[model samples]
Target: MTLSVTRTARGMVQPSGQTPTGTLHLSFIDRLPVLRCNARTLHVFRHGHEPAEIIREALSKALVPYYPLAGRLKESSQGELQIACTGEGLWFVQASADCSMDAVNYFDNIPMVHHEKLLPDLLTEVDDLDPLVLMQVTQFTCGGFVMGLIFCHSICDGLGAAQFLSAVGELARGLHHPSVAPVWCREALATTAPQVYATGKANPPPPLPFLPDYQLKHATMDITPDQINQLKHEFQESTGQTCSTFEIVAARMWSRRTKAINLEKDAKVTLVIFANARQLLHPPLPKGFYGNCFFPVTITVSSEKVSQASHAEVVKLIQESKSMLPIEFTKWINGNSVGDVDPFAPPLAYTTMFISEWGRLGFNQVDYGWGPPVHMIPIQGSSIIPVAIVGTPPKPKKGIRLMTWSVSGPHLQNFLEQMLNLT
Candidate 1:
């Protein structure tokens, strides 16, 4: 029989204590054009005792300091987004699967389509009164559980999400208070220049085209430690400079993806890479300030330039783009600019590439008494543009896992050749 998940219980989990109620304005970073959506992640735990209940209870307590999560999204009279801390609570669901962890290979090999079922479904388009946080815990027959968490992107970035998840884990372990007291200083990130935001509100980017299921293909490939080392050695030999593994992989991905898609020589191809911007601020955001602070480092060039460029050359291009992040961030924070493209909502006909690096986002560090999760993956894959997500390696594994989505006919096969043919 095909395995299935059954929801045993579901409800709103309220805070353990009275939470402050008010209308909290969002930060400038929180109002980015591309951040008006939900973020999703699934975590796998191989062993745990009543994890669903433990997490459910812990979530209630976790909502006190993170009270804004218990609230709903609302709009101000001036048509700006803000939070109404109603103490309505977060949506929680307890579920059980008919199969064991081993049945699915600990979810390491599961398809992205199946991951969609694990997360709580929400409207593709969010609106006022929508819950900011929604979560579900599906317990496996073998005492393991998979936690599907979705939070508003406007509230936090990947690193900020990690911070919130870590709090829930700590509370589940019976901690009286979070190690890092949560901070809500959105004003610190307020922008002096509001034209970009105001203009975005008036003329939002066009809606993304959701391709038919058959037209999209989701695939992944692993880059092992040895392979990474070899690439680093090759890069240093050729360029006489050191770079992160992401720089090498992303550079290669851009180069091969451009060639595989067969864009016009003069066609414009863009790459948007996710990078942390907490320290890029003049004085830096305060610690424990969980909010949207990731900046998309973008670079666009002619297809002829990227597709024909050497791997080392492509890496240099990405490096140059990244090096400009500090200046770009400074300008944006001061309201002097809006990025070339939105991080999540890039503009393109068929030549946009997006890369989000999750290896250092702290997802692997969240542990709920039973110990940290052994594996984690995002539930995604239904976009017209080619996108790649690099996640932290699961336990006992080294290096990173690449999850890719492309609508092109030769997308996966060509990408595989690019990954393996590093000669």
Candidate 2:
């Protein structure tokens, strides 16, 4: 979709607040394209039908401390730095009351709703929308609701945005003061000078050709516990190998998608797995070091390998890739060693992607005084289908919940069938 830029009243505000002192640097990773979308839902208490005034009041108060950086958009002026605080940046709104609570809940329950439809619908209505970043609230008929969030990779990574959202939830509930305060580390991400580079090593791979005028498509499927188990058993039975929920599903879908696209056999596809390194690094990142801190752990293989390989072999390859990540990887990113690399280079084989929130450890306890959310559904992006595994909300009988954005309706249906077999 074409991204239109227009001036707005919100973008003119100056950064007059108590800005932090140090230069928070972001490493030179590609300006994570404006292509990223981090969507999610939150179910509220049954009786929590506070008037829209109260809700707005709560959000206003909670978001004040974050205002300085929250609504600001990025702008580059003559190769110099500039931040546009007016007319652009983060966007927030509340969905119309026409849709009932049950309808909203039903919508959330539908796995991986396609962004092609949902995102455009949201943008068309929210006029001042920035394809780069935005968030909104949708109320349901049952007095319950969902919070939809979207972030531009240029601002914060998925984990970074989650950190920001958790803080918002906490502030609304009157929890502790805004966490760790927001910091802009964009300067730290400047490209390195050629002299600083280590010579003799292989030069970074050529940058991936940008995909031209691509359109977004998304799909989702729901699977029962029994079905999931059966899929797992079938995969093991077929290949004598086991895969994590994401690996198994991802492998199958990637193979199918590449074939459908009519890709060449020797062409490699890249599976970019978003790894949450919050606790994996040394001296672990502070509880509030929000920004794009995630590093992609890629698994590259050709379409032929993916099509001919057994499920077990693919699973092993995925597992091996994950195992390769270490604390040093973060350091590598921070040090700019990763700069020589291209963020979009196509893989040697069919590529698919995975991101999981299995533990739900950090933000699950977000109690905004209204009580913790009974459910949370993340919106899927337009580029690549992402798999997110989150803990079911506290209220709905303790168990694991899986959510994913699909590339096609047929692919999603087939995936749900395989996942059902696992159960």
Candidate 3:
């Protein structure tokens, strides 16, 4: 088969040996990179014949700007680049097929769930599991394809990674330059010698609090359009409040979870809201400032209160929590004004973490030559069931997608049933 290769900018492809040129952004240098983990699915379409050459060309060109990271695969001398931080991060693999590409195109169009139980098994196989990044491409028996990506948690937040993927997509589509340049602002993090100071003086800090231990169970629940409307009506009826899908689902799950854990009345059952701080910060971050750009805003209700609260009340509590996420609070956190805690420590807040990225903020606009991904799901981590709320596409009538980690099977089932009842 004759291959057609298109090279737009000669200099864009930096040779393998060169260091990243251009002035290193200072803030990016100062702060440790925040890790963001997620995945994207792609569907490849061929017109009559598979454009293998064109696809390869697009991938190569798109990956050029990210060449530094891609090229690091070739570099063994740089120990930092080669070393894996916690034996639990990214990995790359491939899947192959024997049939024609067209025969498999239909299968590529849909979304597939990565089974939860398979995670530990998957993790064990990858060397240096933590800090491991993966890019797995599967080729079906026909010409169809699937791509899976896994990122670490300490490098970039979800938004940051989305920004990076957008760039790659633009490049793959033959854009000479990315619409938004990547930003690096790690230096902006406060420069206190010690992360925390005791009584206004520097002192060795006490051991950080340990995160609660819990196993996650995953299940898929469906809600009908009528059911969704009913749930919305019931929510307003119960608490004189209108709630987003996230609020309703999150509230039900949180309540049931606390009940199952048997948390005490006096103990705080905190629902952490991962609020994006990008726009809130003074001199808002540039489009490229992809590090950890979100902070936790929490609502700590007594377990008893939570158990007794109506769905509306929970929604309101979630809404009120947003008020605590002012940019100043983040500034305080980065400045060490608040109690200093080790960045590497296990989660300090009460165990639960909720993250939402439902509205695609141009995240799906990433159009490598193939087209934007149909779905994206986060594989849950060990201790926490980080809930990622995603917006459903046009065809899938599902109200919303809840990607959760480490939730109990029975509790999750109960929460879904309750949600359906409310609906």
Q: After superposition, how far is residue 65 of candidate 1 from its true place, in Å?
A: 0.7
Better of 1 and 2 by lDDT: 1
State the TM-score for model 3: 0.68
The TM-score measured for candidate 1 stands at 0.92
lDDT of 1: 0.80
- Evaluated against the true structure, the overall lDDT of model 3 is 0.48
Which lDDT tens digits does candidate 1 get at residues 1-423? Answer: 356988877677899999999899887667766777787788998898999889988989999999998998776766677888999988887888989988887878746236666887544454344678888899888999899988888888888888988999999999999898889888877657446564324134577575444354677778888988888888899999999999988987788878877777999999989898889776898899898877778888999999888888998999999999898877766766654533435574467788888887888989998888898887764456567888766678888788887545556687677677867
The parts of candidate 3 lying over 4 Å away from their true place are: 1-94, 97-133, 190-213, 223-243, 259-262, 331-336, 340-353, 358-363, 383-395, 409-413
Candidate 2 on 1-27: residue-level lDDT in tens? Answer: 121222111221222234333222233
Cα error of candidate 3 at position 30, Å: 9.1
**Candidate 3 structure quality by residue, lDDT tens digits, 1-423:** 111112121111222233343222222212332222334333232221233333334444444444323322111232111221111212334344445444533332222433221121143543432322344444444444444555443345667666766775666567777777765565554344343311121122355456555555554444455655776788788778677766666676676556655566788766765567778765677767766656667666688988777767776787777766684455554563445543323253434545565445555555656665544444444444445354443223446655455355556665456544542
CA lDDT of each prediction against the hidden true structure:
0.80, 0.48, 0.48
Question: Candidate 3: lDDT of 183?
Answer: 53
* Pairwise lDDT winner, candidates 2 and 3: 2
**What is the lDDT, from 0 to 100, of the residue 149 in candidate 2?**
48
